[model samples]
Target chain A: MCAMTSAQRVFTTLSHQEPDRVPLALNLVLRGARELGLSIRDYFSDPANVVEAQLRLQQRFRSDVLFGFFHAALEYEAWGGEVVFTEDGPPNSGAPVLGSHQPLSSLRLPELAASKGLLKVLQAIEAMKARVGDEVPILGVAVSPYSLPVLQLGFDRYIELLLGDRAEFWTLMEQNIAFCQSWANAQLAAGASAIVYFDPLASPTLVPRSLYQDTGFQVAQRTFAGLKGPTVTLLASGRSLGVLDDLAATGTLGVGVSCDEDLAQIKAACRGRLCVIGNLNGLAMVDWSPAEAERQVKAALAQAGPGGGFILCDTHGEIPWWVPDDTLMALGEAVQTWGRYPLVGAEAHA
Target chain B: MEARTLRFEAALLSMDRVLCRSLLQEAMGEERQLEGIEHLLGPALAHIGDRWEAGELALTQVYMGGRICEDLLADLCPTSSTPVAGGPRIGVGVLLDQHQLGKRIVASSLRSCGFQVLDYGQGLEPLELARLARKDQVPILMVSVLMLNSALRLRELREALGEGPERPRLVVGGAPFRFNPRLWQEVGADAVGQTGVDAVAIAQRLLEESCAP
Candidate 1:
């Protein structure tokens, strides 16, 4: 097998084609930055720092794709929510603006392209693209419309509105979809080759499967359908596997699975259709030894990597301040060593 | 039958299904307040957390149910329940990087157990929280930091209180503390509550202990 660049390997795997080896992809975000010893606050506040962090992250993981923004708060921050910045932790909302039983009509949805922090994100994308457009696949991260509404109107209120009024909920989703389309289009125009929609809150662990399918999944489908770039929809919790087929049908290039889902099951469900990008236990990287990390990564590769359509990554973003550096590095090294393809026969097709 | 049994049944049912919708509705009020529900809201939530921790519920069930409870608490600001006359005001908030559920429940439990409770919500800066405690004239400040990193901020809150004679007694709790017992002293908290029931008892003990001198 010939040597291939990390970007070439990752995009090839994502495209369901053979690469030199299975790609080691880090879903780089604010949390991963802290794990990598960079400052999350500094990254967002300074454009130069953002550029440095992106390059360092790409170098460290030898990642196939480059993620532009770090957290999901930018969209909410742009949609009239006050983001409470932490010293080194992920930023959270100041206070929820929408109330229970509050009519969705009372809220004014902002135009996605004109939101504040979004421009900063777009600028980051432009900077990253300008810097590494030819070297890496610049993947822009966007919050799903269903999850965006949770950010705009606090999660509780958003879920209530979703459960109580379908028409109004979908209208809100339509607005969010419009925002995502414009936001994604802007990022793509700025040089993003693909987009990853992070929808952690939409997990079946948070909402019932029926509600997720009816509201979250549908909104996600519409949002992905509107995106111009190749898209990866990340279902961040394992509880969403029962609906993996529905998720796969959303027209995304692949479905990102969380650690809780059975790898074999997801591989089987996603076979012949969309590719599978993750399912490694992220918390294990925090507490496990390097040897243990390698062992687990090898096991995950054995289960999910043999085929051409798999990309290796954590089930979720790295937890800040807890995960050890060596464990993360071990994961990357393990993927490089053990994730090669052309398995000796019958198992190769699997 | 006993009230505990009834409470247990109500708690189990709430954890399983009933209370989530109403709680979500209550938290997300029609206009978006999401703050005041943490008083009685805490016990209701604790009952659910207890069930989950005790293996009576699955993680997914606990999360989905907990999200509903948290959503409700997040919507309502702390409101006085028949304002305690001459009762020492107690302010409750989560340390930076910590989610507010367990802290909110502790605050709610404190109120039901007869302490004057003020829920400051989640991810508060140590200095800001200390300032709020001083401004509110709270005699007891209950802090909850769920994440290990945030647990260190309790010490910051203590330093912010300084040598002031009016400093409120501090109580801390959460998962990080459960993992690291030494955090109670490391964070400089006067007392630490391991559970919601224990938190209420600690508040009562502190009130009595402070009144003795």
Candidate 2:
């Protein structure tokens, strides 16, 4: 078989067919800033820097996917939500938008065209699409409306409102889904291959299976129904074993699995239905030896690589800022050597 | 196995704060808020924590339960303005990661249990945390983290905080430690809490040990 381009490899893998190798979508965000000798604030200050850094990273690692996501707070920030950006990690919410003093019903939905942070993300996606064209897949991210409350109202408060006030909760969900659809569709229109439907709250790790079924699942079903393009529902390193069936039912093309889950079981469960994107421990990756990195990569490949429906990626979707550059190099190298089609370790998984 | 404890647990799981507060008031009889926390609320929260660990309960239950209890403590004991005398000075903060929900719950639980917990804020560096500990003269500092990288940084935090009889007892908690049972010790913590309720017990025991003559 001829060697495939990154886009071909990813699309083929999503179709459950073995390409030249498993596609890699390293969720490098702050790491990109570090590569260019720029502070995180400076790196994200201009959308051009985000594009340049991502292109440089793709060139250096020779990975399959390009991420157009910067941070989750950007979505909330677009709606006048206060966000704080630091040197070490991605930006985080500064304060709760729906505090007791500021009720959800009283708030007005901000216009999408006026959102600076979100527009910057769309601009980055457009630039990357202009640069890479169809040769590589660019992955965009849209926080699930069901879970965006965690970023908007704070996790603790969101849980209270979710469980205590059903009326207000659904009202918040209605507003969020509208914003989420617009944001996700804009990314797709901007030339992204797919948007990651980032929804950590739906994971059984955060909420009970019963509650998720009643709330997050239904909300996700509605949210996914309106999206114009394909999406991969990401649980952000949260355990998804208990909710795999529900995740498969969310109309997503793929589901990002946590490192804590059994990869083979996940593959068997999603077989012929949804592409399994990950299970690599981003946390452990910080301290991995090159040999250890290879071993871990092979183990994951052995577990889910046989069916050709897996995309190798970090569990949390985004790689940590503190993870050494050498470690990422080792991971890329390991994938190149062992991730080829007709994988030697297929028997172990089969 | 008391009926009130079980009922209180159920109320918290259901997030019925009115019923929860009434149950606590009934269970308390005429005792103080600390007594209710010790005899009723503590055990109920612990049972909820166990259920959560066993996958029988949701994280929302645990979190809301803590928040509800914090509010109840404020309402029930409106004049309990200070920490119990002779207790070890306690402080709480999130390490590197900005996820501060866990820290807030722990701090509130500790405060409800009559410990004056100094809030050191979130995303604090090791040096900044150490400086805060020194400036505040806090003896027992509880640190929470959601990410593994942040959890591992406890070693650097421990070093910066120093090693001596006077150094604060580092208490660690959060998802990573819960995932890896032995991670707390590996990260140089003196103790680890499985939940906000567990933080109360751990703080009490640490204080007892510190005050030993």
Candidate 3:
């Protein structure tokens, strides 16, 4: 059989079929900034800079899927919330726009396409597609409604709304769902292979499991249903089986797991239902020795690689800013070495 | 483990400050206010910290509990003091991190422990923290960095504080510290706290040790 392309491998994995190897990818930020030797502010400004940095990264390391985080810090800015930009990391929201006396019912949705930050993200996606073409899968990201309320209503007020004014919270969830659908559709149309509904705030770490499921998960169900093709749900942390069943029911093609989670349980939850594409502690792996990194890759492949639906990847799909280039390349080396299909037919691919 | 503590936790969980304040006032009555704060409410908030680690409590709820505890502490004590003039009047803040709730909780917990905590809130530059510490002549500087990016600034913060013998003692706690026990130590923080309550205890001890002749 011919060597499958990255998009081919991902699509095959998404279809729950065996591919050339377990698809490998990274969740990256600031790498583009580093490539151009520019501040994050300067690097993230132009679609060309993001594409150039990603292309340079591809030249050094082999990633089966290319992920651009242009959408990561945009939701708050797009929603008219003030964001503080740093040279080192993504933009941070200052305060939530909504408050008491300003009723939730009085709010009007901002035009996501018209928002410069989101428009820049779409521009980056289009530029990535124009340059990379069909060989690699370019994954876009959409912030979930569960995570957006933190910017829209602020944390303190949002919590009160969750417990005291749940009816209004649900209405906000509906609005968030609409927002995500619009954003996801725009990115998909702009040439993204997949757009993961990224929920950094819906994690059990941030909210009660019951509350997350009741409020966040409900919004995610609708949000995921309306997104374009081959999408998945990327939880900031997926350390339990609580939301997997409902997550599989979200109509997403895959589920992104984390290292804190039991891989066996994730495979059990996702196998025959949805694609499973993570578990390696991506952030900490860079600090691990090459031998240990390779060992982990082999271990993940051995455990989760049995089924066809598994696409091996780092947790949450993000590579932290401090990771060294050599360490990242080492991960790719591990993937290329140990990520072969049919343990018996390893020699055939080799 | 008392029934009142459980009821108090329940009141906090409801997110109704009015009902929670009423229940807390009724529980404290007039005499046992300090005991209620340190023993009952303090331990309860610490328990909520454990729940946060176990993914049971929300960030918002924790913030609410912290605010309520702080208010109750103010109502009970009415007057407090730190390490006199040039002593360890501690300065605490969230360092370039978006999540301020944890630091706020830790600050409130320290106040409940009878320390005069000047909380600078969230997204503060490490240099800003150092400048404030120097100007205020604070002896203990506690920082909460819940994210990786925020934790990365600790060395810079240490540099800003300078290595003088009279410089403030540095302490840290948050999600990043929990990830690596030696994270704060690597960043030059003198100490690390496992929880908000633990941070208070640690900060107090660090302050006392610094003030020891």
By lDDT, who's the top model here? 2
List the candidate 1 regions with Cα displacement exceeding 4 Å. A15-18, A28-42, A46-48, A97-106, A236-238, A280-289, A318-324, A342-350, B1-92, B97-118, B127-213
TM-scores of all predicted structures: 0.70, 0.88, 0.87
- Residue A286: error of model 1 in Å? 4.1
Better of 1 and 3 by lDDT: 3
**lDDT of each residue in A1-350, candidate 3, tens digit only:** 58998889888878888788888877665677888898888887887888888877865777777775564657778777777777666566775566446778766787975799888888888888988799888888888888777677766667768777888888888888898889888888888898887775566656667777777777877777777666787776544456667677667777777676778777877888888878777547646777677677777777677757988777756776776777777778877777767744332322
CAPRI docking class of candidate 1: incorrect
In model 1, how large is the Cα lDDT of residue A50? 66
Query: What's the C-alpha lDDT at position A203 in model 3?
Result: 60
Ranked by DockQ, the better of candidates 2 and 3 is 2
Please provide, for model 1 over A1-350, each residue's C-alpha lDDT reduced to its tens digit, 9 standing for 90 to 100: 88887677877887778788877777556644564465666657755566667678668866677777756667767777677666655666655545445666776767755775787777888898888867788888887777776556654455546666788887887777887888888888888888887776455545656667777777777787777888877766434566666777777777777665678777877776778878666544556799887787777776776668888777664344566768777777876666777633213322
Highest TM-score: give the candidate number: 2
Chain B TM, per prediction: 0.65, 0.90, 0.76
Q: lDDT tens digits, residues A247-305, model 2?
A: 88888889998787789998999888889989878766666777777778888888888
**lDDT of all predictions, in order shown?**
0.66, 0.82, 0.73
Instruction: Give every prediction's interface RMSD.
Output: 5.0, 2.9, 2.8
Fold similarity of candidate 1's chain A to the true chain A, as a TM-score:
0.90
Docking class of 3: acceptable
DockQ of each: 0.10, 0.39, 0.36
